[model samples]
Target: MYWWSAVGDYYWSYYRDACERSLLYLDVLRRRGEDYREQSAKAAPHVLSFDFVVLVDGRMLPRPVNYGLLRIIPPPEVETDPGKRPFIVFDPRAGHGPGIGGMKHDSEIGVALGAGHPCYFVGFLPQPVAGQTIEDVCRAEAYFVRFVADRHREADGKPALIGNCQAGWQILMMAAMEPELAGPILVAGTPLSYWAGVRGIYPMRYLGGLLGGGWLTWLMGDIGNGIFDGAWLISNFESNNPANTLWKKPYNVYANVDTEAKRFLDFEKWWGNPILLDAGEMRFIVDELFIGNRLAAAKIATHDGERIDLRKVKSPIIVFCSFGDDITPPQQALDWILDLYEDVDAIVANGQTIIYSLHQNIGHLGIFVSARVATKEHAEFVFNIDLVDVMPSGLYEIILTRADGAEANPQLISGDYIAKLEPRTLDDIRALGGNDAADERRFETAARVSEINRELYRAFLQPWVKALVDPAMAEFLRQLHPNRVMFRVFSDSNPLMAPVAKAAETIRGDRHPVEAVNPFLALEKMASTSIVVNLEIFAKAREAVTEAIFLDVYGSPLLQAVVGVGSSQPRAARASRGDIDLEAAHAQALADMTRGGFIEAGMRALLYVLASGGADERQFNALEALRNAVPEAARPPLSKIREIIRRQAELLRADETKAVAAIAEILPEDSGRRAEILSAIYRVVSGDGEPDAGEMEKFREISRLFLGKASPAELHDRQEA
Candidate 1:
């Protein structure tokens, strides 16, 4: 009787606790559903933790759009300098609301504000105006940038633009269109060379191919009465990882239902708020980007016939991606360099400073919103953005190592990490791996097939779909979409879920919490894990089958011949500009060799010491620290300083020894002025860690040039005088 009673008691306890947990889980989900409904009702709502004021409303532009530019109001504790370059963040409009860049205290906006730069955000409303085109959006963004630039005329450079995901490519386009107006640009979690990806990884690249070239995209637009719902795109993202969407995420909340509610609701507020786009806009994106893959090759032209070229953008570019991001892998994020330039030499010739940083592990959203990334990568970028602007044209990798006992100038380091820009070659980017020639041929054929299918749908099927869908029918269909329906059913709008809230409240009042080591809870987690594994297996298998079909169908010789995109067909390469003449560039640099003085000599000598490879924030930080050595008013304007640095670095690249010898000529004849300059140069040079053999040798030779004729002093006066 004792043994039987003990077994009965265990069963009773398990049954009672499970019921309570179920009620609480339903309560949490109901709260999430309600939060989603409330957020969806707002217009142009952002999750920005900081306050902001609207500056330019794109809806009011001549070619109106749903976009708007807002100036971020920094908190009282943060001081912004008007003379510093302003930072404008463009959040991705890919099926979600704006403010991902400033969604938290530690984010891209926070990084810029902490560095004393003013911040602006370009966000959009939930619905696009009728007949709004992509060109209208682009044109409006360009105007916003110009307005920001014009207002900050006292600043040293053009506004630095930060584009996240979908906005990254748009930023690149605007930068190319008006190269003179953009400053340093950082594109995070963005994929530009859409056709470029490794097999078995980032299967999202094959989505257009699987759908047979976006015929369904046009069909959806037609069925929606000429408007496309962003919910479809959101569904695509969720489907990419079935394990996460189907089991892991929901189960985590169910298991920790009490503690996880707030975080889940906060994220869903942004994710659940879907936007609407014009059908024509959706068709354009599908054709020019998803299927056609023409942006990197400069094959995409504006309505007025101006080709969109990536090479025309003159500002420095920093690409931050991750190996763990399944959506926008490093291969997709960095392949545009391979698509645009033949080699690193071509990159340097074009006078582009391209820097990329790779994280070992981070998801797509984490790249923009994770506090760890904000404190590390974003902080380093803001801290060294000016150095990037003045850096010579070349490819580089940004490396951040922890600041610890072995650091040479730990005192000079601003944060916990020491950041450095190590020079990289095109081979380094290629090492990441991507599609080969055979894969390109297959993709080309697929593009051709897409064009054929798109035309077929337009000529045959579209009219029927458009005719069948009236305004009321379209609205009903949109409301019934799976993504929207899930929220509606669990929200207060549903009477069935109403009793769940009352039961949850009663359970909380008489809470009987289970032990952490409950057998039922353990079994529940095991089942959840098994379900997640099975779902992932299913997703991968589906991807594999889709990929196989795509390759076989498009790779056939007869199909290729019929499509006129066969192996014999020429692939699109970078458009030839032949604009960067290095010899002429060297000659131009030589003309300015005799034009500068003490400050120029110090910078040139520092560049030579750094010529062997590259320097980090050490030298820049050293200069800032020694700024008090001279009067603030006496410092040369930022523009003049950039010009001097560019010329000096160019001369050194063309003729190193000649450039070093000419440093003496640029220096003043006063022995005291020469010593003052030499002292300043050495102080900056020693800022970095102990020099290697080659660097030390160059430093010594440059020191010889500086002390050619010297006496004593402190920080020298500005050279422009």
Candidate 2:
């Protein structure tokens, strides 16, 4: 009888817990549905944490667009100075509404505000403007950037541009078109080379080929009444990880309904709010950028017949990508360098400074959305923007080192950091792409096939689809889309879920969570794991088969010939006419070596020493302090300082020994300034625990060239004492 009673109690508890969980899950879904409805009511819904005023509305432009420039008003707690450079952030319009870049306190806007910069955001409406095209959008964005620059004439320099995901490419287009208007630009999770990826790792690049190219996209747009719903794009992202989309996400909410509801609901608000793209815009994106992979090759031409060449972008570019971002893998992010330039020297010759940082394990959205990433990587990028601007033209890898002994926490840690801008090369980028020419050829074939399929569909099928579709039917179909259907079904309006709210409240009042050691809990865990494993297995199998078919079909020489793969050797490199004459430029720089005063010579030598790759935060601080110590009348502007540094770096690159000797010859043999420079160098190098042999050698060389015969160690020790 005791054993029977025990079994009864177990069953009762299990039934009660299950009912409670079910009610809570329904409540969560109800909240998500409400958020979705509320978001849908707004014309331009976004998740920005700060209030903003419209600076320039693209709706007012001659060729109107949905975009607008917003001046972000910081909260009272955050102070801003007009003297600081303004920041303009452009959020991606890929499938989702704007403001993911500024959705949280630790975000792109937050970091800029924290750094005391006046911030601006470029956001768009959910519906495209009537007759809007990608070219119109690009023009509107360029106008906004120009307005920002004109508004900040008193600031130290031009406004810094931060582009997230799709916006990254958009910003690049603007910068390439009007290079002089852009300042330092940061592009996070942006893919420039769509056809570049490693086999068995990046499967999304193969989807277009396997699906018979861009015809399906054209068909979908035609059926949607010339408006392509972004839900399809969002669904593609979800399909990339079925376990997360189909089971783990839902199960996570069900298992921890108490704590995870708010977070889940917030994310779902953005995920559920799908935007619409014009049919023309969608077709161009799918064909030219995705299927054709023409952007990296500079085959895309604007409406005005101007080619969009990335090398024409005069601003310093910072590319932030992650290894775990399957959507925009490192190859796609970095391989464009290989496509555009022959080597690092070519990049330097073009006078473009490109710096890239690769995160080890953040997903695509996390690159822009994760609070931890915003606080750390975003913060570092913000802090080092000035450094990047002053850096000489070349390829660099931005390395961040945590403060000594800080615990490894994913959340933001407010502290000092040591950043190293180490020089890299085209080979570094090629290594990421695995340097496979055959794969590129296959992608080229896919592009040709896509063009043919797109034309064929437009001629044979698109007209019929357009004729059958009307606005009413399109709206009905959109509402019933799988992405939207689930939300409606679980909503409170559904009579089936009517009892959930009251039952959830009762459960909340009398909660009884099962212990971790419970046999039933263990069984639940096993079931969840099994479901995830099975879904992952299925996803992998599908991807493998898709990749195989893509390769087999597109890799055939017959298909290649039919698609004109051997035609005219890919597009000519769209070399910018503004490309510098490196030899003449180097000669001019060498001549300028004798032009600056004691302060300029000292600063140049100090920069040369730091370039050896061992300088730390302490050193940078000391150098800044030294620069500040100069009288305002004598001190150079930040722009002038950057130019001086650039000239010196170019001279050093041309002839290091002569450049170092010239520094010693140009400066007056006044020991005071020399001692001050040496002291600052020593402080900078010692900040990273202590200078190593390489650093010591660089320092010694600087001392011999600038300060006659004094050992760097002696000078350092003397200064310390």
The number of the candidate with the highest TM-score is: 1
For candidate 1, write residues 1-106 as lDDT tens digits. Answer: 6977866766667678778878898888788788888888776677899999999999889999999999999999999999899999999989888888998879
Q: List candidate 1 segments past 4 Å from native.
A: 1-10, 568-571, 709-721
- Runs in model 2 with CA error above 4 Å? 1-4, 405-416, 433-435, 567-578, 610-617, 669-707, 717-721
lDDT of 2 by residue, 1-721 (tens): 6987876776677666767787888899987877787888897899888899988889999999999999999998999989888999999999998888888888999999999999999999999986788888888999998898899888877889999999999899889888888789999999998987888877999999888899999988878888999999999999999999999999999988888998898888888889999888998899989998788888889987998989989899999999999999999998888778888788877778999999999999999999999889899888766667777788889888776654332122234556777888777877775436567778888888888888899899888888899999988888988978887777776898788778788889998876566666677889999999999999999889888988888878888888777634453354453546877877887787677777667666766666662233445545555567789777666677677766667777777777777777677777877777677667655655466676677788888776666786688686777
TM-score of every prediction relative to native: 0.95, 0.93
75 Cα displacement, candidate 1 (Å):
3.1
Query: What CA root-mean-square deviation does each model show from the true structure?
Result: 3.0, 3.2
Model 1 residue 491 CA deviation (Å) reads 0.8
